[model samples]
Target: MTPSNTHTRNTHLSKESEQSQINKAQARYRREASDAAAAFMQFWRKTKEESTVPTKYKELMQLAIVLVQHCRPCINLHTQICVQVGCTRAEILDAANIALAMGGGPVFEYIGYLMQALDEFDPPKEAT
Candidate 1:
């Protein structure tokens, strides 16, 4: 079976794997095509990791952009990053709503994926 198929199949069994798919794919590509992958990763670091904007805001903007583009993996990746950078659910939804306003119905439909990803990566914290 294809790797993507395996990722989908394993989703119910391993949310951890789901979150790592992008990292795994990047590792495979770097191993298989070292020069090209290195260049792309260098570019990724410059744009994503070194942004003048705060990482939290950059991650939120990325989530909004990917939601509009209908990229499920990117949405999941950025959602996880946003939470890691300390975004609350309200902030995540606020970023997501920008996509809805810009892309309208299609984006509205896909917001479900954002919701699912949010739940997967950052479920609500239980109150003490």
Candidate 2:
């Protein structure tokens, strides 16, 4: 009796372990999230390094806004990067407004999604 009970417990545990492994394999990669984050990082690095542009930061912010409006994950990643590089909330909102003007109602709908993501990943408060 004791041996049978122990065998059943081990079998149950083994099945759970196998299921978890299968789930992980099934959910691996997630290309959209990975790709968007990579693209945002690459663009951010390039935009920051170039020296010829007039109002470089603003230009970068404008581009970031367009990227964000098109891609929600890109918006979250780039917005966080922008905040790291001294972008203010007002500036971000302004860039988003510019996107709204260019992309219209569909763009406006995405703003709420982008804002939700930004709020989720808000930068830490700087010391005064």
In terms of TM-score, the best-performing candidate is 1
Per residue, candidate 1 scores C-alpha lDDT tens digits across 34-100 of 9998988898788777457988888889999998999877887788888887888888998989989
Best by lDDT: 1
TM-score per candidate:
0.73, 0.52
Computed on alpha carbons, the lDDT of every model, listed in order, comes to: 0.82, 0.64
After superposition, the stretches of candidate 1 with alpha carbons farther than 4 Å from their true spots are 1-11, 14-26, 123-128
In model 1, how large is the Cα lDDT of residue 86? 81
